[model samples]
Target: MIRVRVVTSRRLHVASLSTCTTPDSLLAYGSRILHCPDPHKKVALTFECQNRWKSEALPVYTGSLWGSDEAPGLPARGPRPELLAPKKMPSMKQLQTQASIPVIMLHALAHIELGAIDNYWDTLVRFDPVKFQLPRDFYDDFLTVAGDEARHFQMVDNRLRELGSEYGALPATRALLEHAANTAADLAARIAIVPLVQEARGLDSGDRLVHRMKSMGDKESAKVVEQIVWEERNHVRCGMKWFQHLAKVQKREQDQVAYFQELVLQFFPDGLPGPFDVEARQEANMGTEWYESLESKVAHPSGVKLEKRGDTQSASVAAFAASKKKVILAGSVWPERTSSAAGVRSADIIQVLQERGYQVLCVSPSRLNDHTSKLQEEQGVRCIQADANTDIFQKLLLETMPQLVVFDRFIAEEMYGWQAKKYSPEALRVLDLQDVHFIRRAREFAVKKQGLNFKETLDGEQLDIDPVEKIAIRELASIHRSDLTLYVSDFERDLLVSRFQVPDMNLHRCDFFYPAIDVSKLNSFNDRRHIAFIGSFKHSPNVDAVEWAKKHIMPVYRNLGGDAEVHIYGSYGETKRFVKLNDPKQGFFMKGFAPDAHETLSQYRLSIAPLRFGAGIKGKIADSWFVGTPCVSTSIGAEGMSLDGLQWGGTIADTPDTFASEMLHLYNDEARWDVAHQAGVAACSARYDASRNGDSLMERLERTMVEKRELREKNWMGRILWSENYRATEYMSRYIHAKNDGVNNGVK
Candidate 1:
């Protein structure tokens, strides 16, 4: 025989606090606890709040269950403990001294416990569960946590008094609250920093303190620390549970781990130290994924782990201070991922730099969203709007003092490179020549000059283009000027070294990284429906590919396949040229913008990239293979993106008729399609695995940083080019800026 107690506004257990003291709203109860300065009274209030919530069910507000009247302010206290800012806090490096260690340790525990009490209650009031669409259980869990923290505080304070000291006997630091204040506007961030990081870290602290006490022949004190650690383990579990709930509610379920790691970096760039108690943390549902990435970060520099959490302030500050290596990624306004592969390429570069243990700041002159903003919100990539010609950029340079400055393209270097060199002279200037603009322009010129349809392949294998175009001359000089140049293609890396006489040591082949996507998991050949081509129309290579496809490949493909349609997917499709080509009746459909390219490609049987000439890795072919939908591309289109020996996961044919023929054969045969799909997966694993590329890039960047001065010394031509060209670029930019300023000021 069992009885159930339903929670309601009336009463569950029929025991209640004074009606006036215990408010019906959880929010009002929160205000009282936060404002209460008397530590003992605060503890009393927490126990009362907990009992009242469990017995007389407080109305968890749908909309301030107090009915839209203003919520009450926190009751003002006469005085607060002498709160020390993070910087003013004293270091506790010396763990042992002539003074009683128990009191010192107990005081630290009391401060942490008091903070924990506030952390839970403040979360309840500020981030309304109803407003965030959170479950009512959220308030219940936090109330329980608040009760535990209040009890922990009492226990620690009692221990302190027994040792002839009371709580607030010494100055204390509120770094937790300060860091929490930084994320006051963001609830998810508050949760990440407060409980997931700060409180969970307390578990580590408790373990050390327990060991310390037992070592000092204070078994009784060790028991008290042990009790706190046990309760804290549960408190951390509550945080992890609610955090997962919040992530699902906020639609960050898939990105929870990555976003959690990012927030940790954003709030505390210096890695959080740990000889993390794995058993305790795992019991709390806080896995190694959350803290291990960070553990090897600050204190564990060069892969050696820090064994101790010396004291509260030093461990916290050492882990919180901005001592980590830093890098600045400057390019277009921001990463416009949908606009071109250039955007994707730059985003990947930032990922590798971050993996290298550098805190990245992405800066651009243009305002946000003109190009796509890469949700600097989650990735912890700080995006700042500062132009090259201004004092803002100069100030930023001095403040960041970045160890590495990667100009996204030669053009970005051409824009901000001179300014970076002037200011952060010691910084390694890596030129990410995403593609050699000169080689691309040269191919485009040769095609146009030969009077061929833009997609017609060059007759001979040997490449020919004018070496004297302004873009070529400018790009070549830009290449030599940087410390190390990053190339995406083997052919291009070799081309600069052999043909252009740039040193091979000064160049590196860094390609796009892809985590291997499982082909078996993707839609099978029979499940997929149509033939498609996807690209951003802003790029001429894509526009040329489309024009060539419509004119040559699609006609042959449609003629043979009695029932097949070519769906064109891309950005900038509203251009009248593409708009006029939208003929659905003839099986050529135009999809303006596909928000998810992988999803779009999965619905297609095969993709056609009829690019006659282009530089760098072809993203469309990559996308096709990424989704296990085989692609048909020309040799030029398939350049540098080989899975095995010259294999691009599908077929490579130079001629239009043959390109169409190869795609149809692969589409018709399931066995052939399966092989192609596996090849693509293998290619992605080999070529674009982020772990491989990111680690390699970090190592390369570090080596280049060490060799920067010597490398620059070895290149007399590079020095001459930088001295002459970059300075001239500097003057020209300043002149333009002044002219624009004068025009705005009505000076002319």
Candidate 2:
């Protein structure tokens, strides 16, 4: 036989079942039986049966007939009336009648209480109130509500336990709380509808629970329901007071009831209509007139409308016509003969412009054919392919008529610089000084010769310095011809202004804009091991850095008996010499061409860029810092970083011995390693945040545009002189264009 009992504790209700069976079996049966549609406070039953004696049996009877012994032949009858009535059942109404109203009311209180708790935590952590005008009183009220809600959850939770079930044992609803969360942006609406409206409904529902529980003879549970009713009246009053205060302060002369009704219509159109608890509301301080006015309004919530605007056609046209500015970007010698650094710079500038809602066009040698056309389709960028050295390129420029033309080095002086002026005179021309190419070449030659004699490298060269100088003259000539020039570093800018005698008006220092990749994807420094050397392997300096590390640094790690691997990676093939230098036996691994440098670098314990000599900023070092991989580099390699007093992430060790020692120390000492890694990450984030550097670039672009317009107005005389000087240059280009066109026609 099985029996069930419903219990209440701390105003919560639950049902417990007991049977003469194993605990596990009993629990399983209890779970199923409790889930039945019928609700009863308790049910008990007792079974009785007769024992066999003689062939002739006696009839069983109750009340009047005690022990009946009719003669031995008399027939037997079945059990009595008490046994027949053992299967006592209650109707659905009776089952519902058994539940305590106060317990049900407390459950409703938990709904709003939990919403307040969730909102309070979310507001404090997620949305900083300092950023908004959230009043102190608002926070105070929220805190007060949160405390009451805690009490409510505890009260309900306790009652559920007393009833032999836990809070999660029964199905629960968060419909009200979810609504509150969804409508969080507007606080007053939340208070009005959730606490006042939804909760007022709970107050009425509580009365019903108490009535049913009392009729079922569960007087204890009934008492708990009554307690919740008393406290909730005050809670609803708080909501009422705040709602009226907001209405008065905002000068909402529309009757308070009508205003609340309008808010409900606007914010919660799907809400239920109500014959509200007028007495309870009045006690909570809501006026009868306001309540009546609220009941009159009926509407559904509508979706909010937002506006959209079209392309900024006007700004684009204005920016282009403002003035003609000149910019020169130098340094171009690389394996492809098209500067990779310049490509990075162009991409960065284009990205920044796009972010600021500007229309931009990209021109690259790679874009000359279907490849460029396809790129345009995929990237949504307008790209054109024109040779820097051809007269046809100028014709293309005249057709496109761009406002700004950026020249990265004097790749083709006769083609791009002179012809741009001849074709698009109004376009602002800019030059990017990637580095002092001449000085870089001179230094490279001197280092190769194993001597400090710089003059030897320039003696026989007609360009007057070295290999890089020949390029620099053409580069400088292009700068002189342009309106403005951009230098990546202060050192490079100063070198042109002070050493090369480039005029101040033609120069502007624009630092390199680091490429924006997903920084969050990088794992923290703790996950990495192995020292890495990253750079374009084709570059002489990077090649030198790698070779120096393999020969000088690896032996130290081997001697120290540490398990550190040296990984050399960049964009180049492993030549015979490189292969011989990177032997697996020596723990050297050559990983070729990392398309995503930061992603690859992030897996390394430390980065090494022991560049013997180089010009301009090293992208590899910047990439290392970006990934929080501390680097060890020479002073030349670390130049222009402006990382003042910050531990070199590792060490600026120029000598082989010092480099080896520093590398070992950083590898073995965890504390020093952590500090360096943190510093590197900080440096990259602070120095290269788009919000900081990008703003300056935009401001400079605007200023340059204005200044160029002024210059054009003041230098109408210079323009005429320049036109006369460019006439000869224009004739030569036209002659070349005609010759090329004739050849193509003849071939056809």
Candidate 3:
């Protein structure tokens, strides 16, 4: 129990202290630091301990047989600063609003530094260097870290005093002390938990605190915090270094990641989800492949995957895969139909699969939200919150034995495709392009950087150097690796074929079973009022379009005597910019979070999508058509939804004046509006004709299952990639299961 619980008191003299039985060795000096009740004295003792070790006045011990009391693990304390449980400590949010924020923050930081000093010293005394076959630098590096921790404490304490407060002004938590105590007996585990996990987390938090201080105009305080953060990287590096050294000495070098993974999970399970300071961590040597694997939240959504099944196969498991027709749909996000069009598309695929007699289950590496939880609990489609490269998901694969495995996005395919292959080799793999991600990203970069239009961006050489070009490489590989890939747009399909030379047979255009307008139920052109723009605010294109409409398009429409008031409708529109744009006097209303897309859209005469940059065919345009709302959209917005000779619902306008002109004409002319309204209804029906596209999608999937082997055999690139990708994903997932496999097994 290498624990640290402290209280402030008068500093003690070394000769009077009786805790260190052997008062001359390095272990005795280290133990004496922990026994001191005063933080300043602890800091002073830490430096003295380091100096004594350097001067050969205090030698490292060979064994602890003479004294267990030398490192009693319970550090001494005084009375002023009351110790509290972790839950009782003041939150950062609470501290931020107070005048005493600087005092509380500085004091709290000092508390951590003080604890670090104790923990470093405890490590020095608790482990025998000779018995562990350790070098002198193991003792040296930790002593250096201890001195730094002491200096950090003194620095923070000085800042606190200058703020009209002292170190005991705030209460502190024993969480850090408890962490070290929990792993005290296991040397490797203690090093992994304390330094790698806790110290690395402190480094992450320190970066943010430094930024926060600077933003609040406290640059001096920021400098102090920044200095601590910079120095702390070496502390993290020391942890990584010694953990490797200790593991090698123990003949566990081959399974270092595996052993480290188990220790982290056993102690801290939710994982260190960092808005990670990658640069600092990379410099610290904390950037390793296994860190992410060790930190992954890999349990089943229900948190019951580890539970034992009865001797007889459970009825649920039997029914789960009994039909011999199951499909697994994996994605980066859980489906939320009310939030984004992607959500609706996700729900549509699941519904389509289930209707075709396949048992459907959705797997995603996202947290369960209200919408997704409802879908899982009530919608009869099982949605599991699981990461791809995990044994939990691998076990799920074997249990479900899905005949078809569909990845709704290229990113999902990149994550789960290889794992699915390793576990279920016979499953037909499908990647749904969902309107090429890189297409949108490249257009976005061009628009933001070069102020270029979608057409111009497409023709230019910008994709060659754009960051999204790297994404384009991954996307293309995902397409090539799949037995079949689904595309919502023919334009996107042909573009990939012509540009990347993707095989046409390997791709399928599946509009698939999406809800369309009940033509008989649609509102008439004469019945509707107001102009509108409808899109989920979560989509970058929609947010940009709203801004563009406000700053450029809507003002022109009003000046041109467009009588109809413009209304904006979408989900998740709580953005501050959106709130600022909702000026009723200007006749622009942000009618946010439409529950029923069709019904809400049906009230508008026409919609405007002044989208400057986007990739996918606009779901807003499709929704507009479904509700019989004619929409005048930019070319990028109307792309893939238009035909060569056929009329679009309203018109395509790329410029501000053109958009205003076209919108005004459609709103005023009743006969023209009627024709446009009918075109919209026709487009929705033609594109999403459930019986036609639904059967076609299912038929294509069924056919691919039969031809899976033949299709994969012809795709030599996929075979080559599977070999490379398998190795990468295999070792990652193996980390999660390593403890069960035994520590010495390594990647195997």
Candidate 4:
């Protein structure tokens, strides 16, 4: 046995051991003594005894054998105490180098783990309790895990100090911490995947370090690290348990394993093999099945088929895939359902593409429109309301240079798509046709004289046909010029191919997806009694519909003598006819500008859309169906909606008497209205479910892009010609830039 006195700045303590008796034993015991306060301000290790022991009762002190107690320069207060014993202390630089890795790993791990824990807590706070159904113990478990990580960090740090190094002393790579920061959006993902999946890989390496250090005779260092390995096992186990709990609670099947594998490939696409820890995974309760599944998924992500298009075969699709980095969306009129069908067309495509991957740049003609401005601000989309005809628009296009250029209508044909193609050939150009304007206007004139004639309607409108026809032809030409043309319906595609002579290779069909509506929010009609006409009053066709309805249908409804009100509601209700129609005394109600169409439409008994002429799917019909409001419309009103022969919720009549009688019958009869409403809802759900439409549209876009890429890649001569043209455009742009700079500097 040996006796030793441990001196600190605050007090002196005595140690009596039964087995340690050599000079080396006494020195090793002395090495455990630390100063009263930590040398470094961050953290320190200290030891203290509860009771004091008499020196006479202890074994002989071996201080003189290790080092002289009463040497020169001894303090007057007492004999000099050893700061550190030679047996336990290695060379300072050597110890620091040895401890640097684990200490840095611990500090970084603590930051990452705690951040993940806090993020989970915050997410839980924001999560809708009803939607997620998280348990009470979820948060408690997170806190416990955080506590364990903190303890692990402190323990590893202490071991680091024993090896003559401290935290912040080593230059450690921030790759792990950086990855953790990058994936902060999903904390459960970080905890379950990163620390458990990534950091758990460190376990084997840590074990190897311990074994190697012990073999090198650094037994004290090895013992300290043994504690780290034991604690890390539990820490990783915590991650595994929570991860499994989340999977079970969320009902995530094997698909999540696939998703996790994809995420790993995305983050670590280059694949680094080895340094994987199977033992730690087993200890952490991670099954071999999950690991194997993850491995397979990483090797091959599900549904990751690539289709080549244009020059894409020459360059991998990976090169063209949307980077998670910032995206720039440059276009005109987004999220606005204005009279310009282009506005609606561009908005729909932009919304769909954005959901898939695009960072949208929404360029509108004007910022005065509330719908466009509101969508831009709230949806985090960039909106620029600049004249596409001007240099400013070109400058903006050049500055952003979006990967995809989506054109709504032909108005900006020469300015946006064509000009962008002429300037930035790298951008894939897309054209969206809301409808054929020529056909719409031709039908509008033809319907005025004839009661109902679909083919004969376009016979006598030549001059009116020319301007509209020219625009449509130019727009279609622009579509041909573009890489891809997106049409709202397959019907529209056929019409374009047959009527406008658009090539089949150029056109792709993508149907309109109405805003998602909850069916339960609709008011079920027990007894139908009212007829409603809803549309934006600014639209000429809708305005014409209302005027016709007032003159032809209203009188018949009045004659029937049933209590039924005709309601006209939409934006821009200030027109004189609308103002005159608002007289409640006449059973006509012009409810101006509904805050929400679905909300307002749900209350209506029956919907009447007597559209004189319109191309593409009618919004009034769609809105009515969304709220289970049975709609009565003329044939032109249901144009391109694909509702032909599939009994529309209401009758399609051209004659005033038949239209009026059908509306009256539907309004008066409850059973007829209920059947129609159900049919309409079914039509809406089956046709316009965004999930289905969105998936199909995305697939088509992907296919088109791939096809275009492959085409360019396969045709190297064509690509070279295209590149030469692009370079010429670049030279022109440089000339313009030089001219602008000269003007600004007054060089001219």
lDDT of 4 by residue, 163-217 (tens): 5654445333333224434554454465555556655655646666665566567
Deviating ranges (above 4 Å) for candidate 2? 1-342, 364-374, 388-392, 412-414, 450-468, 514-525, 560-562, 644-647, 709-735, 741-748
For 1-748, candidate 2 gives per-residue lDDT tens digits of 5554333332112223343432222112223222222211101110010111012231211122211111111111112101112134333354346444443444444444444444332332222233333444544454444445445555555665676543333223434335535545555566666666666766646655666667667665665555556566666766776676667655664576677777776765534344344435544555334433233213223442222112442242344334243222211211121224545655566566667766555443322333334434544445444433344355555555666666655443323566666677766777666665555655665666455532333222222354445355555665666677766666566666776676676676565575454557666656888988877644667777787778877787688675788888765434434656767988898876577676788898888877766667777777788777888877667766655665555567767677777777887778898888777766666566666677887776667766887765554433553575644444554554454344334422
TM-score of each: 0.55, 0.50, 0.63, 0.50
Which ten residues in a row are the worst by lDDT in model 4?
44-53
What lDDT does candidate 4 reach at residue 304?
47
Mind sharing the TM-score for model 2? Answer: 0.50
Question: Which candidate number has the best TM-score?
Answer: 3
Candidate 4, superposed: residue stretches over 4 Å from native: 1-334, 337-348, 365-373, 389-401, 447-455, 458-467, 515-521, 527-529, 583-585, 643-645, 709-748
lDDT of 4: 0.54
**Residue 609, candidate 1: how far off, in angstroms?**
0.5
State which candidate, 1 or 2, has the greater lDDT.
Answer: 1
Ranking by TM-score: 3, 1, 4, 2
Kindly list the per-residue Cα lDDT of model 3 for residues 57-98, writing each as its tens digit. Answer: 466642334232456566766675788898887687775655
Cα lDDT computed for each candidate against the true fold: 0.71, 0.53, 0.74, 0.54
Candidate 1 local lDDT, 141-239, one digit each (tens): 888888888888887787777778788876677675555357666677878888888878777666567767987888767767776776667778887
Predicted structure 2: lDDT? 0.53
Question: Better model by TM-score, 1 or 2?
Answer: 1
